[model samples]
Target: MRNRLNRRVAAAASAGIGMTLLLAACGADAIESGGDASGGSDGGVDTSAGIDCAPYEEFGEIDGTTVSLYTSILAPEDQPYIDAFAPFTECTGVTVNYEGSAEFEAQLLVRVQGGNPPDIALFPQPGLLQTIVRDTGSVVPAPDAVEAAVDEFYGPDWKQYGTVDDEFYAAPNSANVKSFVWYSPSAFEEAGYEVPETWDDMLALSDQIVADNPGGEVKPWCAGIGSGDATGWTATDWMEDVMLRTAGADVYDQWVNHEIPFNDPAVATALETVGGILKNEDYVNGGIGGVQSIASTTFQDGGLPVLDGSCFMHRQASFYAANWPEGTEVAEDGDVFAFYLPPIEESAGEPILGAGEFVGAFADRPEVQAFQLYMTSSDFINLRAQGGQFIPPHSELDTANLTNPIDTLSAELLTSEDTTFRFDASDLMPGAVGAGSFWTEMTAWIAEDKADAEVLDAIEASWPQ
Candidate 1:
């Protein structure tokens, strides 16, 4: 079924309609920034920035060769890549066999250890890229050509997440702004509340909402830590955003680079702060325990209730906009807006969670490089915008083609003023600490009343030497 969908999308692209048309025809709206054709000029990509990819001369390719790709992308969401890659295959005759992201990672580990890795791998987290670079020694140092390609397609900070020891290990493919706080305008108006600008303002607003409601009903926040294998990632985002604002970019960078311990005072304080919110009787929709055990699927579905006036706000990635109630009109102009997670205090900068997809190559073949460059280029952005399968990472991409409110708002926040975007803390942390111990410890802290000190100790113990 997945292969058939890919072939159909490919056939359409080959016929020259592009993916954007396919998306619209399928009834998926391409969200655009600000609802205006101008495409949010505030902090958007500066068209003057020049990134030249002419340095690494294109290499000749051997026909009939195949490149195997492993990814965690679901079939429906991955249709775009399948469709997009079909063109590359036709142009270079290099067939691509893609697999699920989770299965890909597990299999890739075995293959690398056994000396038979794929030509390219699409890792979801930067931590995985770090692991591959440190373990297999098969990943080629991101060449000058790739670096130039990144600069051309994305902003300067774009490639920072995948960089290790001043060398890049992957190409950024999909990105979700994490610093956003989603809320229904109708709910806010019904509650007679205004969007808070600063962190204190947001807290004060939460307090007001709780005070007015009294019981656990009509809560101000909706939190779910229930993704099956990746359960605690949502909680991690909340902690990371707060930490970034509390500790400042310098300290946050240290934590990400493993220069400081994960249980450092700064990180601990951040956890305690989030815990306080979870513990608050009126803050979260179902209270601490309710949130702790709530299935991630339920948590995602909880957004509709917020729109129905059951909760006031949700802190999630920009992607959640897609899950809005079926009939809920996301602003007639197709703009989905999210508040920047207010500063924890009167901080100098507003911290945001940067989450997105990245592309990496295991083989240094010319065809591979060409496909990488092309996929991340303006051409692909235009194609994706038309298809509604992706949101553009490059600010310069023609957003006029986008109509989905979530996609449009995500692009808007990418270049919004006073916003400081940083990668998710866990993604930057060592995998064991980020994906394993952190989730387990945080969940335990929330549901089991684990000692704060004990939680801190557990996280500290998990830090890589």
Candidate 2:
């Protein structure tokens, strides 16, 4: 059934109608669902769409090749990427097999070291990519064509994210705007509240919410750092967001790379700033309870209180829209929406906190290289955008193609000429610190009510030597 769908979609693409059609018009072809994927003969190529194959043609014909891709994007989110690449398969008669999982980071390392790896893998953090590059040296660098496309389509900063040892080894695929706080617009209007324009204003608004509580029982902010084994990630995000605003990007980078100690006074200062909110018994865990409850509330349910008017704000990423109740409207005037977490007036520059995934290949086969290059190309980017919920790093993306207003705004912020964007700091740190101790220690500070200085000290002590 999927093969027939792909054939129909390929026909539509060849006829130049696929780019503007709905997602169902180009249902993603699942290579794994087909029988004996490796036994397929070359399907006919379709150039009727008038797609300029000039850029991809140099990789030579790879009519029967099958390329496997592994990623952390998972199920529904991964489908859009597969659909975006359908034209690649249609043009070259190559099958792109894709698998997504929550354990991509650990499993990818195991696969590479065990002498078996996918043709390509998408990395959510460059630090993990660096570890694999430095340790196994098994990953393939981006082809010249891919590098050139990245240079032409994305900002230099994004290119830097994918480079290791000064070699371009990966290409950014998807991105998320992280510095946002969700709130109920109608509730804000009913309570005569306005969006805070700066960090100080945000705090002042928090105080106002507390003051207006009928019995002084309602808090102003809600948060959750609980995410199972990855529990304290949300708290780490607060520190990173505050660090960019309080300590500036240079020092933030130093902290991530350990050029500055994790226990440095600047780091301490950021922790305290986070404490002003997360550690304040009056500021968090609205539906969940006091500050301690933040550690128990699942991250998925963290922001829900805002919808019930128990909390005024919930700091989270743009992708948190998925956590909202189905059929709930999410927009500036809808049930709930987000605003960029306002910048601090004292910061060195306006920095936006964000995260994204990078595409890297384990084999340099022509088919693998062709798919890699195509993944970041403008055509792939445009099609993915049309398929919905994709924010490509390509500087030239047409924001209008993004289906959601929030997503379009995120794209605007990321590509704005004056905005200096930084990837998630913890994600860029050594896993022992970024994914391990940092998560555990932050949870201790919130759950055990540990002192700020003590928590920082513990994390600094845990930094991998």
- Candidate 1, which segments miss by more than 4 Å at Cα? 1-66, 89-95, 102-111, 114-118, 142-148, 211-215, 286-289, 295-299, 325-327, 332-337, 364-367, 387-392
Clashing residue pairs, candidate 2? Answer: 14-49
Per-residue lDDT for 343-427 in model 1, tens only? Answer: 7654536555676567788777776766566656665555555434356566556666555555554454444445566767776
Write one digit per residue (lDDT tens) for candidate 2, span 301-351: 789999888898999887676567777898777899887787774554666
lDDT of 2 at 174: 74
What TM-scores do the predictions have?
0.76, 0.82
**Ten-residue region with minimum lDDT total, candidate 1:** 20-29
Clashes in predicted model 1: 18
Q: Looking at model 2, report the run of 10 residues with the lowest lDDT sum.
A: 21-30
CA displacement after TM-score superposition, residue 393 of candidate 2 (Å): 2.4
Q: RMSD in angstroms, all models? A: 10.9, 9.5
